[model samples]
Structures are given as structure tokens and as C-alpha cells.
Target chain A: MSVSARPEVRPAERAEPAGTAPQPDTWRTRLRRDWPLLVMGLPMVITVTAFWWLPTLGNVIAFQDYNPYSGGIFGSPILGFTNFQLLFSDPQFIRAVTNTLGITAFQLVFYFPVPIALALLLNSIMSPRLRALVQGVVYLPHFFSWVLVVAIFQQMLGGAGLLAQTLRQHGYQGIDVMTNSDTFLLLVTSQTVWKDAGWGSIIFLAALSTIDPNLYEASAVDGAGRWRRMWHITLPGLRPVIVLLLILRLGDALNIGFEQFMLQRYAVGSQVSEVFDTFAYFSGLKTGDLAYGAAAGLFKGLVGLVLIVAANRVAHALGERGVYSKS
Target chain B: MSTTDTVIPAPGRGGPRRGKRGRAPWEEPGSLAGRLGKGGVIAVVLLLVIFPLYAILLTSLSDSRTVNAAGGLVLVPDGISFDAYRQIFSDTVVSRAIMVSTGVTLFGTLFSVALSVLGAYSLSRPGSFLHKPMLFSVLLMFVFFPGIIPTYLLVSSLGMKDTYLSLILPSAISAFNVVVLRAFFMNIPRELLDSARIDGAGEFRILWRIVLPLSKAVTAVVALFYAVGYWNAWFNAMLYIDDSAKWPLALILREYVVNAASLPAGTAGVAGYGHSVPPTLAIKMAIVMVAVLPALLIYPFVQRHFTKGVIIGAIKG
Candidate 1:
């Protein structure tokens, strides 16, 4: 799941005032002057248009009874909204939607604050060496592939895993947490925490370090205790960052890491594991129900676009830049 | 993370009166129960992160006898051996996958960084030809996902299926990376470029000799991001590459490790080690190590640049 961080372009006033600049160049003149720069940008433009934009345009297949063999997107007969109707009625699609939303909401509540708390804990450590060591150990997992993470968890918690073996040795029944559908939510949440919580804390820690040390000193002189200082000063300092990240997370509610669920689908079964991306992969690519799958994907994408635009407005209402600024 | 480094007071600033480590005078030391509780939490967090790594490393290195003695994943190393690594390397599937992953990461990162640097530089100059429209096109991607089916259909229709180009081309230019690079580029003093322009230094020359040398940290961080993405990627391979022989390490890793499939029968013949083979668990853990070691090795060097890189895109964005 990728959260798009949109950098607002800074004003160009530093170079020259637009009002005071020379007369506007003709299109030909500008083209002649800027051809070299445009040449630099050509490869990216072609690549993105071909790979990103063209595919985006191809989402119109959702409106057709698309059959590549008989007719491509243009030649296929259009049956607008029929695929969407079929998608909504399909129980599997509904389950996928429910599971995706459920997981997103669950993580928002349970997994979101972890990094904030971790940053706080790390900030409290007086020894820089110990802090660095802990940071290094925790951040290592963020770089590991999802497959490796799932494999590690399996060795530790699967039916024939370390935990199970240790339990059997003690005359207790072995537990297979990895394959337990009932606790799949908790299992995935824990895995996500283990993998990403440390890396997520980097931003919060940066925000924390930017907080003036003088605030804590001044608060202490006023007889504020640690908890009070944390509540009154530290949390306030982290508020802007916390709000900004929270908005981004809200915008990304539909996007979860697809590989994690894809890997575990067989273990826990798709009833609990299927998500929108996995659903699209199975229904569209796996089964060649291109129209139906595209409809499902387009529905999700449209909703995501609307949600993000709405969320950005909320960010601006709160006087933050959000992902994209006015520029 | 680099931001935390500045939190430490310089000795000269503090007049050497304050020691390297101590609670400040206004702060009360934690009570015994509290300190122990905090220490216990830290220890648990550390163990949670470290134990799995330590277990896998030990298990991968353990001999079959030691692995059998431990029942499952060997937590403690009784005997160390390279038998598992030897078996894994000897397997053509794994060796080929490693080479594939390495090649993809190297070529993909270079291609991506070069594209981003070019695009970012092109757009960094405001009032240049078509800057607004071009930037809008790039930023539009942040809000709109092209959806999977269309992308898959497009790739296959273009006859890129079962090819390495399918892996790298789709994700070659991340808009965020381009924007971040552009943001860094825009910060360069205009006078520097103007002086170069007066001396007849072309835009490329200014970018090469001036901008890049000054922006090494962000560039390295961006390159690291792309390299890691290329290394860890499997979904694209799964979607596009129907040929299992062309599978990268990550895809093979998923099939072998997560799925817990037995190695192909000829894997032993390929290794030429019919006797004294390590347990399958050791081989699995060894594969995990192989997949992870590059990331672990490369991370420390770029760790310090993370906060700087992240902040530029995040807070500024």
C-alpha cells in the first residue's frame, strides 16, 4: 500500500518577479529555448503515459462486455453499469469489500498509535547508543519482503512451529495461530505492527526532535510531571504531524498491502483473507472476467479518489497543506 | 531519525558543566517500579524484533542433527554449518532467482533514478515550456490509481508478458520521487545556474556538475527507495511473468518459503549432495536470510538520511 506524498511546488519568486520579467516569449521561442529540458522529460512522459495513463484510460472496459479474443475494448458491446450491478450482488465481492474496510478500520484504531507510542518511548531513552541499537533492530523488518515476514511468523506460530512444539513438549495442545481464521485480524495486525511500526515512528521522532527542548524545561520548572509534560507539551507538538498522517491514512483506507493477504489466503482461507486487490486479481486476471473485475476495481478507485479529495479539503479546513496544496 | 542526533546538546554550547548523560535538574528520576516497567517494555519490544531474526539465522546455520534436536526452528545453535547455504546455492532455481533479483534491482534502480532526475530537473525550472501542464500531469497520478485489470490487460496486449521489461517499465517513475527530487532541485540558488548559463553551461551540464553533487543525500535516499522496491517486488512478477524459470527471488521465496513446498526432486541432484543434507526448515530459513541480508547491509549507510528525506516530502508536501 503506497501513500502518495504530494510535494507542493514552492513559489518561483526567488528567481525573478514575474511582473518585472521580460516580455513573454512566443510559443516557438519558448520551444526553441526549452527543447533541451523537454528532451530530458520525454522518457518519463512516454513511460508514464504508456504504463500509467493508458492503463487508466483502459478502465473504460468496465463499461463493456470485454472479450479480447472476439473484440478489444473498442469493439466490445457496451453494457454500462451491468458489471457494477453484478459486482454488488456477488457475495464474494461483498465479503472482500467488508474485509478490506474492516481491516482498514481495525488498523486505524489499533495499529496507528503504535509508532507514536514507540517514538515516545525511544525519545525517553537517555543513552543515544541504546536508542540507536533499538532503532536499528526494529527498523530492519520494514525492508524485508512480505513473504519473508509471513515465513518468519509461520516458523514461530504455525501448527508445526516453535510455539506449537514448545507447547507439545509441556503436555499442552499445539496452537496454529497462523491458520486460525477467527484471529486472522489480530494475526495480521500484529504482523503489520512488527513490520512497519518502527519505520513509521521515524516521522514522529523527527517531529518530536523538532519540538523545542525549552518547553519541557519550562514545563518542569512550573512543577509539571512527566505525564503532564507529555500530555501538555509533547502531544501538542506531535499534533500537526499526527493529523497530517491521519488524513493520509484515511485517504488510503481502501489500499492495504495486497501481498500479505495473498500469501496467507490458502492458510486462513479467502473468506477472511480476500481483499479488493486480491479479489480483482482473482476475478479479472485469474478467471478472465475482465469486465466484471474492472468494474470492481473502478468502483474502488473512484471511491478512493473522492475520499482523498474530500480528505484534502478537510486538511485545508484545518489549515494544513494536506497532500497537495493550492498550487 | 537524523533529527534526533541534533537533540543532543553540544558540549561547547552547554559549557561542559552538564555531563554526557544524566537527568536534568528539573526532571525527577523515575521510581524503581517505573524504571523496571519501562525497561521491561523496551526489552520485550527489542526481543520481539530481534528474536525472529536470531532464531532464523541460527536455524539456517544449524546442522540437521541440531535442527532435529530442536524439534522445529532451532532457537539455540548447538552446531554451526554451511550445509544449507551450500544446498540452496546449488539449486538452480534459487541461484537463478538470486541473479534475477540482483539484475532487476540494479537495472531498475538505475533506470528509475535516471528518469526521475531528468524529469525533476526538467520541471524544477518554473516558467519553462509547459511546466504547469507537465507538473499537473505528474501530480494527477497521486490521486488516481489506474486500477489493476486495465494495467494487466494493457501489458499483455503490448506483448510484454513473460518478459523482464514487464517488471521494470510499469513502476519505473514514481511521482513522489520525482516531486521530491524536483523540490530539492528547486532549492538550488538561481545564481549558481545563471552563472553556469552565462558561461554557456547547458541545463544538463548545470544538473550534472552543480545540482547532483550538492543533492547527494536526497538522491541516495531516493535510489535506496527504488532499489528496495525492485528487490522486494513479486506481485508484478506474478502478474506478468507466466514463466516460472524467469521468477525473481521474491516470487520464488513466496512459493518455497511461505507455501512450504518441498524443493523439486532434482534440486538434490543439482546440488550433487545426496548425502548429509540439512533439514528443509534450514533451507527455508537460509532462503529468508538470503532475501534479507542485502536490505540489512544497505540500510545503515542510508539510515541517517531518512529523516531528512522523509521530512522534505512529508511536512513540506
Candidate 2:
């Protein structure tokens, strides 16, 4: 409930007077003073710069006629928006964009409330032991690889799976939800809920913990029933957290689990399951169209950045602490 | 089961009945109605979470003959056998894949954690020349940047194709881990660093000697995350590694579970070891279990650390 006990500020550390500027010192002395932290930071700086940042710069190939074998990213001739033009011309790329947006929208609407519901249900339980057991069980799926999760689902619900097999044994038709395109969206959303809902509830539970116990006591005294109290107090208390999480989810809407979709792509025949990342992976890497793939990826990244910033702005406007302090 | 029965509990009232001497309505003792309601909730939760695991485990343990003959649900194996596991382990290909997976996970975690800790500690400091920009870049990496294709091209063009580095380097330092470690490092008193400085302790020395020891919980958590990420990593392996021998256990498991018809000869050695039993659906399940077993084993030890790590990582990042 308290998040944590207020971090203790030892007296010796507090000895420095407030509102006083640090003493001017020699550059050597200043370097010596900050050197430990700086040195500690060097490995990360070098690693990220070389691996993440430099490779990121390679995305510039999107604007060039880059051929991996013939010339490197820097050596490639500039082609302006040719890659974008190529991407626009591809019907598959258009389908990818549409599918990605559709999946993102589905997850946002259908999958968003699951964690909240789970948290509330878990919160309602009085037995800590039972609550914990349930929590652990539900969270186990999150650790599983998307491949395993999909396989598990297929083994249980596919046409030849346990459920369908049982139906056939009883002289009924076997339902094939796994490879059915019409049910693909529902299938993916359900899988997402199964895999992440419990883990997602951790934040909501943290929010629940912050609700004042005395408020519940007062509500009880007023004879407000469980449903009414949930409506008035619990939901309102969770408003900030829900809004914050929603904003975060909005920021990650484009990222809809690449491996999960990719694994099932063959089964569903790509018509229903080709999202942006998988689309890019197949187009760029599989097809050797490096520039085109880079362009698509860069496009997704820009959209994500804009969404995050816009969400943060909206959160700030709504008078809530966003994911980051604007400073 | 019915819509009306799932009445939303009042938030502030806690539940339908409360303060009944350690008995909430959800768990109200001695009342049939209350007991039934509580049992129903527990049953539903259990069904939703536990049943699939049970079903999978049962199917995985069942012999292929029994599985085929049953023609439907096999809640319990007719006879339990270790043939599946034996088949997977005995096979040279599967064994080699496991070795590759283990190697990647071990090296990847070591490199990632080492880099992340150092970076985080540096970033945690109050001021440094490149601090703001570095921090912003790291955060930006978390939110957006070059997509997977560009990253794949980068790896491929750098001549890392079909090499172990493809798996390790691409995701070496997670931005989330950096943020978590930074939060933990910042929590360390500056006075400690000052005193260490006064005592002629070098920055690296202080970090290794003092900061790391105090930050065990977070370090362990971050290490676990890195390890799990590496262990479960298959996308990179699928994309970059063209050679079958270089496939990690997860990638192999993917082949086993998704494309079981083409059970590679690698898993056949273990099958031979287990009394000439062929790798079947059970073995595929065993491979899945093997792939997931390490994380499951490591998680309980670091469970407490995980919650703390996430809170710190989320709020700080």
C-alpha cells in the first residue's frame, strides 16, 4: 500500500546544505569526482552506440538504392522516396498495414479490460494463499515462448486437438478454430489474455493497494453494497492507473508480438495474420529488399514515437502523471 | 455462469459482506449461498488457468499409440513413459541444439548484464557530459527506432550471419534493464560513493565492491530477465541462422511443436536411447518442457525481485 517505506536519507548524506552551488574546481578534479559514474557508464554507451545506434543509422538505406552485396549502406546511391513508392505499390504491404491496425485496435478494445477484470477478481479474494496460487498459475503462461503458447492452444483446440477429437469421438463435427481466418482475431486476443492478463494485473494490484482501507470501512458503514462501492470507489481509485496503462498500450499498439503472429502465419495463410513486423521481416530479410524493409520498420518506429509522445501529452493535459515526467 | 451473478463488487465495501469476524461474503463460512459463490469463483479461475496446463501435461505423457487409439480427450495417460524426453535428449541434433541454446543464454546474459549495470550506474549519477543524451537515446530505443528488418540487415551486413553473435549482440543491453539497474544504483547513498572516493577506491572498484553487493536483488532480477530472453529467443535464430546445427533449443522446439511431421534426425538419438521408441507427440511436449524448464526453475528464486524490478523500471523509465 505504501509502495515502499519512504527511502531513508541518512543524516551524513543530508549534511550538504540545500540551495548552495557546488564549489568551482579544476577540470581534473571534476573529472575525478564524476569519473566513477562515467567509467561505469562506458560499456553501455559503447555497446548501445555500436550495436543499437549504428545499426539504426543503417536505416538510412531506406532512402538509397542499397544492395547488401554490391555496396554498404553509406556507399549506396541516394534514391529519395523510391522505397516508399515501392512499398505503396505493393498490395501485400497495404494488407499488412491494414491487418496491423486491425489487430492493434482489437487488442486495445477487447484485450485491455481483461487484466483489470482479473485484478479485481483476484483482489476480491480474502485468502492470500489462494490468491497467490491463482496468480502464479495465471502468470506461468507469460514465461512461455509464443511458439509454445500457440502450440498449446492448437493441441487443445485445433481440429485434431483434444476438444475436436473428443467431439468427433462423440459423432460431432470437429471445430477448427486454429486455422480459421474468420476467428483469427478472436484467437489471437484470447491467446494474449491467456499469456499476459495475469502479469498485466500486477500494476492494477499495485493501484488497488493504494486505495485507503478506511474508505472501504466508511462505505461499509454507509451500507453501500459491494457493487455500488466498486462503482464509486474502486473504479475511481483505479482511474489514474487505467488511463496511464491505456496510454502506454496506445504507444505499443504497432508492436503486436511479432513471433506469435509469425509462427501462426503459415497456418492462417498470412491473409489474416500478417502484421507490420512480420510483413517487414518477410519483405526485407526474406526477399532481400533491405531498403524497403528498413523503410517500413522506420515508418512503424516513427508512428510509435509519435503515439508515445502524444499519449504523454494527453496524460499531462488530463492532469495525471504520465509514463515520464515532462521536465 | 450467468451475467447477473457476476455482480461487480462495490469497491469501498470490499465485498458483499465484510467484518463478519474474519469472514468476507466471498468466503463467508457456514452459509451455503456464500460457500457456493466462493467455490464457483475459485473453480472458474482454476479452469481458466490450470486446466490447459493439465491437459497439455497429460497429452505429453501419453504414449503415441494410446494417443491415437483414444480418438479423443486423454485426460490421463494410459501408461506414463519417458520415451519422449529420452528421444529428444538422445538425438544428436536436439542435443547440439540444447548446447547452442545454453551457450547463447549464458554468454548473452553475462554480456548484457555486465554492460547494463555499468551503463546504469553511470547514468544514475547526477551529472555527466553525455548523460542526458545517452539517457534520451536509451529511452528512445525503448519507445521507437529502427525496426526488426533494419536490425536484421545490420546483423547480416556486418557478417554476423549464421554466427552466435547474431543472437547475443542484437539485444545485448535492454533499455528496461538499464532503467531498473539505474534506479537501484541511484538508491545507493552518494555518501557511500564519496567515502569510497576518499578511501582511494576507484570508480570501478567502488561499483564492484560496494554498489553491486548492495544491489543484488535488482542485479539478480535483471540477470534473470536477460537469461530468460536469451533462452526463449527464436526469432533471431530463425531469421539469421541458416545452419541447422546452430539452432537453439527454442528454435528446435518450434520445429518440434509446429512442424512435428518433419521431426529432425537430431531428436532421434534420444529416442534410440529410450528403448528404440520413436519421437512422438509426447517427445514434442518433452522438448517444450525442456525449453521452458530453466526459466521455471529460476523464476521462484527471483520472484520477489521481479515485482520490485518492474515497479522501479516502470516508474523510472
Q: Pick the candidate with the highest TM-score.
A: 1
RMSD of each: 6.2, 7.0
The model with the greatest DockQ is 1
What lDDT tens digits, residue by residue, belong to model 1 across residues B1-317?
Answer: 00111111111333221112666777898999999999999999999988988999999999888988988888877978998899889889899999999999999999999999999899887777887777777777778888899999999998999999999999998888887788778778977877677666777898999999998988998898899989999899999998988999999888888887766877832334555878888888899999999998899998767644333343211
How displaced is residue B252 in candidate 1, in Å? 1.0
Docking class for candidate 2 = acceptable
True C-alpha contacts between chains kept, each model in order: 0.59, 0.42
For residues A1-327, write the lDDT of model 2, one tens digit per residue: 010221222223234446654454445544645655677677788778877888688789889998877777768899999999888888998999899889989888998898898888877776766776777777677777887788788888987787898888789998989989999999999998888887787777767866876677688678877777889899999998888778767767787888989988988888899888888888887888878888888888888889877877887788865656555
- Encode model 1's per-residue lDDT on A1-327: one tens digit a residue: 011121121122224333443445667556767888999998988888899899999999999989998989889999988999999999999999999999999999999999999989988887877887888888778888888889889989999888999999899999999999999999999999999998888878767777777788898999999999999999999998799789878887888888999999999999999999899889998888998889988988998899888878888799875778775
**What do the candidate models score in CA lDDT, each in turn?**
0.83, 0.74
Q: Provide DockQ values for all models, in the order shown.
A: 0.45, 0.32
